[model samples]
Target: MSFFPAVGVGVIGVLIGGVCLMSQRKSLFGALLSMEVFTLSVYIMIFSVVWFSGSLTSACLLFLSFGVCEAALGLSVLVSLVRSTGSDYVGSLVSGHF
Candidate 1:
């Protein structure tokens, strides 16, 4: 119910998700999923803060902008990579020669 605990938990979740992403970078989908999870955790923290502090308008706007940009950028990069390499596995691209 307290803001501190909510923010703390969100930070922990984001950290854990980051670790997961770094450890699983060989897989494209895994990294994307981890990033999505991290983004969601951050959104949760922001929303919680907004709720407690009564700043929902700015927080929600920021969240929407960030979420849309993140999704678009991630998907676009993934699609381009896949199209160039003809594979969805990131490991293959790293080991390949241009």
Candidate 2:
């Protein structure tokens, strides 16, 4: 219903997407950070739309829970990768010989 929220969300979504897609992220940290940013942007857009509609509170809560879980999973994976490879380089996962 609001003009500004919609415009703001669209702009943020575009900027984040462009940055994530264009950047040559080489580390697992950079990749995870971008993923988190993407998740946050989605949450913000959904929350804003739901705020205007005054419904789908359940959906927002579910999305928040899922986002938290995803972040935790990503962090665990990053730690594991660092411990095993001694670095978080994205190429290490595929290029290193076992």
Question: How well does candidate 1 match the true structure in TM-score terms?
Answer: 0.77
Estimate TM-scores for all models.
0.77, 0.79
Candidate 2 residue lDDT tens string, 13-85: 7578658845846787887787777777777877778877777678989998999999899999989889888
Worst 10 residues of 2 by lDDT: 89-98
Off by over 4 Å in 2: 1-3, 94-98
Best by TM-score: 2
**RMSD to the hidden true structure, all candidates:** 2.5, 2.6
lDDT per residue as tens, model 1, 5-62: 9888889889988998889957677788888889888987888888889765776778
Q: Residue 2 in model 2: shift from native, Å? A: 3.2
